[model samples]
Target: MDVRSDTALRLPASDVSPWVGLIGLATLLSYILFARSFPEISAALGFENDLGRLSGPYSALLAMVLTGGAMAAWSVCVEKVHRNPSTGIDWDRRRPVADVLNDSITKLAGLWATWFIIAGLYCLGRWYWDGAYLFAMQVMGAAVVPLVLLSVPYVIWIDRVMDDPRDQSWHFGAMLIGRENFDVELVKKHWRAWIIKGFFSAFMISILPSGFAAVVDSDVTEIVRDPVRLGVLLFELLFVIDVQIGTVGYLLTFRPLDAHIRSGNPFLAGWLAALVCYPPLAWGVLGNILQYEVNTADWAYWLADYPALLWLWAGWLVFLTAIYAWATVAFGIRFSNLTYRGVLTNGPYRFTRHPAYVAKNLFWWGSVLPFLVTNGSMVDMIRNTAFLALVSGIYYWRARTEEAHLLLEDEKYREYWDWMQENGAITSRIARLLDRMNPRKGMSGAVQPAE
Candidate 1:
């Protein structure tokens, strides 16, 4: 068997790298030490001088940072091990920290400048109904929304530019963008088909959270505030982490009999869809419960406050869903190398070639609907709508860039495009409607029929 195939088939070593092991050990030690002296730490930090209150939030934050750091370190180690041993991975030794700092500052400055412009617009609305609630919403929309949206594109750019040469693969490229070569025709051909698949996949994955909400009677906030509910939340969070790590390991090691066929790694597209939808769904459910539990007059307050949170949450959902859907369709089209994965492509794919993108837009809108309708604030609605538009525009740009690359890399994609055009399967009025509804503007207007 080829080396890549062999590596894929063999199980990853049960033993982690020494560095990872040490980091894990250190994290555990730190947590333990900190937990033992929580009272002292809380007192020093001037946080109520109560260990319990401070411990949960403090430990959770620390754990998140440590866990994130360890994952980054682990990725680095894996890349190093996979590199050729003879020459070793070359370092950009001459690259200075100052250069990196400058680049980061430039990106941040641009992001902040855009944010300030939005803030000015939001301020215009606030002048009419200036209040504490409006102020809070304005702060969040102006500051947090821009920061998160900016990070999404920046991260994608960074990943492509900074990815290790050795880890570059057809699969990785497809995963990052819709097509490895970035062929618009090929993407148009398969977009709707993938969207149908993604929608069902997303719908199925949403069952877990839905089930959790159905079974749990108490409000999520109440539950979270309680020790047991908090514990359950922690467990759920840990489970997600474990699932993601395990999925990565599985992808690295598992080689199916056919290389052309992509495995449905739940962690990749499916899990991502779930993660995007579940939190807001959970929060929405919780909000409902809280609304019910509280007095009638207080309902407006919770609704307004919670929906603002949901707006940000929805923004994240839309962003992640778009990326995930794009990756899924791209991977299936490029890596699977299958002409047709069964011919019942009449649902999502029938509308357009890229259904996942469509679904992502819907998901975002769904998350934000509660906030928009509940707040009755045109400012919040317009701000979110604009942000969504910006997101879509960026993704469209990314799609176009990827399509160009795909046309060059994959000849099959050309045939796929031709077939789609010939068969009247390329685009539809419904698809165009969906595309227009997409926050991303200036997407391709022409749709080719599938041959």
Candidate 2:
């Protein structure tokens, strides 16, 4: 027999496909039925019954069941479309829906898992400590809701604005969940870079004594009662916002650059380096650790004293704003060359090449100063100074490394550097001071001198 006749002879008939369809339908129905009654089951198990009266737990359960059924049906429809080879589902046509659905499900699963873990932890803590669990829950709930409300929308907005619709395949959601042609080497390189950056950033912000109280011990109630401590807590919260925003921006912009430098041992070297460096850098080596015990009304008390901290916060905000603006402009310029897309770059970057990093360092110093000045502890002073030195050194080395990379890639960058040098626009003083202070040579030999 010919090949076509042989293949047709071996093929299963359409009647056999009904079994697959039946199985999908059963799965959908079961999910719907269970989901519809979930609320009542939850209430019976002592979960809060806040889903309303008439449309209560049962309605929610029904909705869940229906959604699952709908998803299964959608999948079946896709399979049916794919069954016919000649006029079947095309990659371009099928991909977007699959990607979106896959991304949504993955995100939902992650969110649910996180919530479940947190709730479990809360229950465990409550059991261990009398009255402490209830207090912790309330405090955590209060802090969490507001922060989520404020930050989530802002994050979504940032993502939307920064997103290039043409490059949707490059998105984190797509890369992780969709069947895109991903570069394994590129993913590994950028993953390492992000982990390094994120670890350092997290340590700097969270290694404070207050962080330990709020996170590990779960003593939020005690921290809220003291005015000074409350002030520090609020500062920490804002600092978190600044760091997260900057880190996200940096990752998006430099992902391609990191991806270009992939190696077989990417994770091994980077992970080891981060683990070795972060502990001493965050805890022992750095100065001025802010400590707090959890207290009820801590957030309320902190808000009340906002007027006093307003000026300092204002300065900090200004510095952070400048940094973000600089990043936006500079990265915009660099990205423009790739796609010939233009963005406004007339402000901060016009003055300094790496103003964002400089401004961020300044912001850190501003945050550290209030505590050192007010508390006036020698240990705190020394710690803060050490932190400043370490951060500045790191920033200096990074800038030099980045500039050298640019020098190799772009001839125009050399002109820009030369112009800044001739115009005395770049400040090399900080880099010089760092070099003098360190006995060992940095990764990059000389500071490219700030331009």
Candidate 3:
């Protein structure tokens, strides 16, 4: 047998796996670094001593990294078994389920070791920064332990259902970088169990405090005195409601693998670039370099100058949140970041391929208009604009990455892409503009299909 095939049949030596050690060390060092700078991080994000609000999300964030890193290690081991095979022994071939279970247990043990070490280091980091053990214990017990337990099945299921080794496989790209296997039926059936493991967990942990703060700030008894403030408060309340509905809709309809071809890996550069857009990760060192606050000096001061426009801003916020919530609702349970659930051709998706992302970015730009009018330094304005552009670019990257995965995995996506090319509201307009500019010879002669 070829060396590749040999690697497939033989089990990986988990103890000698270099990546496990490396990941463990890296996780330890990163937590230490993040810990050392936790105070600065909180201050930069305007939390300071009020870090209590962030503890839950931050713990979740750390656990995610730990789990992702461990799962990546498992992928590395399994990927070798898949190199250049037709479909390396999945359960369809009647391979003993016990053997598969044992293999999963072995990989899980190795990954668990890495996670345990990182959790310990994270606890130490938390204690070192705040001189508090309560949060540290919570982080360890609540986040790390649960993630490890979750990973046990996560690792097993991927191996059990997705051990097939089709060349040019859907998972090849993601597997190269150690991503969990893609299995639509498995996920669709079991997704309820996963609602908490994914974005829902973060959303739940983060949104509650914001909702509470909105309630704390608002005085519903005297709404007429400041209609603008009232409008803003109502928008906030509605925004929270919209998010809750959308999040639940996402979990309820969570059919992640319905059209999943593959997905970007956490270890990939694409994943890293996309990850820096969100908080906890974005609030740290990586974001320090890439992130720039808009010149809100304009927004803060301009809001007073343009009282009427405050209503407009509030309206935009409400509209933005609504459209976003609508888009998520459209996705139903399939809504997620960086994974293909399926092609959504109805609802907001029919008008444009990326209604949610486009609307979100537009809202950010419009909402910061007050800031845009401020008398900030020219360089500051440029930096802020550039940062926003970079942020936009990251989202663009994510859209394309997801498209690539879907297109590679499913022919249906290609058909959808073609249909959108011809008839999509936004894309057709762009295509016409491009055609007009380029004026390709003979292209105009082709009969256009009626939408």
Candidate 4:
């Protein structure tokens, strides 16, 4: 019998260096910690404490700049991502302004028109004017003038160095301008990318202030006495890290740092799976329609009588949350849903293809303990567990679609997938177990990046 070595498999070469994300993670943590303790620092320095704590939405917004700037600087100064062919930037092939003027104008026209359409959609979408989204709409509305004004010179300058000055946006511009030829496919691509940015960016920005405030204003004095308190605090902190870095990833699609969205996931199934997990759709499905918490009490309530078990369960939940956060950290500045900026094979990804999904599902299971219910109804127990399982299944579906998209789009992802199947410490074991159950089955199949 052949024996497999006990040692861990060699991690595949990561398309994204872990350093970029790690630097961002470190910078983000530094800013968050400083924000958390700003009041004390202000008084200690003999400065007026009029501003109180820097835990507001504006502060949270600034954190994105600090963390993203750190990652971008590292990608440029250290990794030299600008020179990578993937960036589509050719610094050596600069053309005179006159040559690219018309092309730049077309691109600018396309971009401005795209932004205007986004604004129109925002107006039509009732969700944008209500609740948390109000802040996001306001911020975006405030920036429309500046963005339109600034696009002129910015487009002309960048167009000069672009190897192919007529990109997807340019195609869209050409269609509108009516003088130049444009491809229908490229126009679709432009909308796909912009739609992703407009939709997800607003969602991300909307949720930022609430979580940041929770962390900043949290009174942790009782945390030591109660595992529930500690767990909630840690969970909020980890999520804040995820949202802050993730927002930056969505917003900073600049070509200079080579962090631009190369392609949005073209698969309709991919979009459906992702969209169902967020916003108006989720508010209906996951929030109410399929609400799994109907008669369920959390791990804390179940274990309130047993202090040891409560703490243990809380710690487990926190560990899972940490894993989820680490998965985002690994992506660094390239973290976004429904798009392939690059493949990541480092950090928690070295362990599994979808650490965030796994961790998130496991966290829900541990914290909710859907099996145990306060109502003690067999019906409730069965219903809650079943619904949670369906929720996990949704994530599994999302992961499969994402893998299919990536495998088709990039050869690098194929190598990563195969490597994980054979050598990933956790993934390999899981794959083998699944194979045993369904011997004829494979993990995931490749499909179109878009429809």
Q: Find the candidate with the highest lDDT and give its number.
A: 4
TM-score per candidate: 0.28, 0.34, 0.55, 0.93
Which pairs of residues have clashing backbones in candidate 4? 21-332, 266-449, 266-450
lDDT of each: 0.37, 0.39, 0.49, 0.87
Q: Is candidate 2 or candidate 4 better by TM-score?
A: 4
- RMSD (Cα, Å) for all candidates, in order, is 17.8, 20.0, 15.6, 4.1
Model 2 has a clash total of 19
Between candidates 1 and 4, the one scoring higher on lDDT is 4
Model 1 whole-model lDDT (C-alpha atoms):
0.37
TM-score of 2: 0.34
Once fitted onto the true fold, the runs of candidate 4 whose alpha carbons sit more than 4 angstroms away are 1-12, 439-451
Clashing pairs in 3: 87-165, 184-257, 250-333, 253-333, 254-333, 298-370, 298-374, 299-370, 299-371
- Candidate 3: tens digits of C-alpha lDDT, residues 153-237: 6665556655542212223323333556544443332232232224333433344334434533455678745646665665565
lDDT of 4: 0.87
Which 10-residue window in model 2 sums to the lowest lDDT? 333-342
Candidate 2 yields a Cα-based lDDT of 0.39
Per-residue lDDT of model 4, residues 1-451, tens digit only = 2223323234457768889888998998898889988989988898888777788888888888899999999999999998989889899999999999999988988998999898899999998999999989888888889888888888888889989999999999999989557999889888889999999999999988999888887888856677889889999999998998899889889887788888888999999999999998999989987788987878877788998988888888989999999898888888899998877988999889999999999998888889888877999899999999999999999999999999989877887887798878789898778766764443453221233
Superposed by TM-score, candidate 2 places the C-alpha of residue 436 at a distance from the truth, in angstroms, of 16
